[model samples]
Target: MRFWLLCGAALAGTMVADTASADTLREALLQAYNVNPTLTGARARQRAIDEGVPIAKAEARPLVDSDVTFQQNYRGISPFQDNGRSISAGATASYPIYAGGRIKNSIRAADTRVSAGQADLLATEGAVFTETVAAYMDVIRDVSIVELNQNQVKVLETNLQASRDRFDVGDLTRTDVAQSEARLSDARSRLTVAESTLTTSRENYRRLVGLLPGMLEPPPPLPTLPQTPNEAVRIALDNNANLKASEENAKAAGYDVRTARASRLPSLSASTGVSYTDYLGTLDNVTGSAAGLNPKDAFTDSFFGLRARMPLYQGGGPAARIRQAQALQGQALEQVIEVERLVIADARSAFGRYMAALETIESSQQAVAANRLALEGTRAENSVGTRNVLDVLNAEQELLNSQVLLVTARREAYVAGFALLNAMGQAEMRDLGLDGGTLYDPIVNYKRVRNKAWDWSDDPAPTTQATRTATPEEDPRAQGPVTPPSN
Candidate 1:
């Protein structure tokens, strides 16, 4: 019974461990979208922009103000009798009847500003995604190199042992034993460097994603390539967030010019007010009788008025403002054009990189296969005394180098694919198939929180899913292990 209970407990523990270890690349990306400081800061800036919308809209609404005063006097006043104490309260309301479209133009400018802010947020997200993908690829490449070096060390050690045995039997020269030992030492040194590099890459990945790197899973397979460079460029031009932001800024500048032009026109407004006053102590009336009034028994008076004002001249102020706005509009227009050109260029560059990476992967795969065959042949020849130990060691190193190159090329290809997606502004969490519903959509969350529609009191507890899973058949290095290799 004791043995059975222990076995059952061990099995449960193993299952819990497996569950904890299971994660996917998509999950990592969703977590990053939620917790990345860059994304959060961008969203905060966007909310600040939304606040401008209400400020602009308030211009068309009525304005109200109130004033109250209380005074106490000990000495008598000669003019109209004496007031020991007095209290007065007044309120005023004003409404703009007309402003020569200045309010409308200002509101339009504010709207444009809000749009620009949204675009800016999107642009920031694109940049963050690009950096994350690059860091992820670096981790994968470095880990793969470390693994390759470790395998190389093992191969060299085996060769050194064989050489020592052969020398003991007088079948190999002392020079061959020395060469095998030297190769083994070189392999160990390379392994150490590779392990250190892998550690640094893992830390960078962890920092970007806001999680421990070991918890992340391998990224999804690369998508199919775009058929033509023009197609890719068109996609980038149409969808690139930075390009959109530039266009929005240009539109906002145009609105600013309109606002400046409108400021030169006339403004009209209407206002009305009512007030009550009371003498809290004794006051002498015209009949010489003392009249006492309390704040509760105040006399009421009412009046209404309309106001009109026009901007005639202010030292060329309006004209200067208009000119400044016009200059800014022109600068914004130029920026839009520049962004379009840049987006197209980025698309072209990413497409070229993807193509080059594809070619490299193909070439490296071939090289790895060829080098493996050569290493095998050299080992066989050394065993039969036809090839020296140095030949085996050199062949093993070549094979290891080829494997490292192949892994690096594959990772580069994957990264370039992501780069192309980002250049086209299509590299969202959803596009990466990381749409775990936990993926942060700033716009949606902003609307919910800003509108006071989110129920903070009843909010659900935050939950997270594992972002990776281990497969028994898959090598840790191939999937990009986050742990540093043991030297």
Candidate 2:
């Protein structure tokens, strides 16, 4: 009896260790947000767009430039003279008084493009979040499968031992013993496959999150879905990033048209410049007398001028540009329409998948319950000699399969919920109820770094520690012999 108690305690300890070693889903998600390459690339692209704001604002500011000219003139009259040497220096300042409405429209277009860039970054982030959640869930499901299969193998091993004992006593036939062994072998094979699958799933999760896989706490329960697909479609159409980007694009295209049309109007500007030159030379008259020129022969000139340029005729160039801009505007409008259609389709598909996953969860739960009962009954019949060991093995296999299916169904349901949120462009970390208190915010960190919030520029680079580094247990490329399973 003490031996049995010790075994029970050992089993419980193993279970506790396994649970403690697992990483939670939220931790995996945070890691993924921090290290995901796709997201990092998108953020860099957005910063590039942010620079456009300063560039566009620069257009309305004044421009200043200077030029210097050195010239040696030979009049063929004085080869021995300085030959009217002159050094000219000039500076000019100009400011755009007006370009009709072209400059303003162009700036507005740039602003809208910045908005589109932001939307694109958000969309990419949403995509990465969705994928990370899916992969994390996959690892969870695979781990559960491995656990279930391990349990099944344990039960089969126990049954096989019982069958062998009974066969030695002539209470069970050789056939029964053979059947029990076959079931145990099959269970062992399944356990091996489950372990392999769990390893692969862990690697996938690690790749996305840049960390080792750990025990995952089950996600919180989801809210009920919308009652109608139309409701979902409406929400998505209003909030989808792709749709928002398209709308911004259309606005930018309209601004382009404005810019093109403004080209036909007059542009006004003001300019000022100052110039100085010194000329030293001797002029020879036709009477052959040499005359010395005054050093003050060079004078400084300063001028300020206002000018207006009106487009007259360009041989159809202005009209052609206007027509091209109009065409592009039309194309943008059509793109908006196309995006609307796609948004609706995506909403419908996600809603359907969510509903299907829900149904599967229900059916799978029922199957698990039914299979458990069937296996229990088969074991009782076998004890009474009314059923053979093969019947029991078959029932056990069915139960194991049903448990795996149920785990998969639950995972699918969770993923489907997130997918619906993604389709609606509402799958942010905050929406997942994972906000507040050290939650990793990519945008916040990006802004902090970009705006120099922390003064990290002054920090020294980190040095490696002298402590020993730990090696991961599950290396896919290792070629050593496989270890036998612990009983």
Best by TM-score: 1
Question: What's the number of clashes in each of the models?
Answer: 7, 4
- In candidate 2, stretches whose alpha carbon ends up further than 4 angstroms from where it belongs are 1-22, 73-84, 161-186, 279-291, 313-316, 430-433, 436-487
Q: Any runs in candidate 1 off by more than 4 Å, and if so which? A: 1-22, 73-83, 215-217, 282-298, 430-433, 438-487
Query: lDDT per prediction?
Result: 0.73, 0.74
lDDT of 2 by residue, 259-370 (tens): 8888899999999999986553422322234564333446699999999999898788878999999999899999999988988998898888888887987887788889
Best by lDDT: 2
10 residues in a row with least lDDT, candidate 2? 1-10
Error of 2 at 406 (Å): 0.7
For candidate 1, list the clashing residue pairs, or say none.
22-468, 23-466, 23-467, 23-468, 23-469, 24-467, 24-468
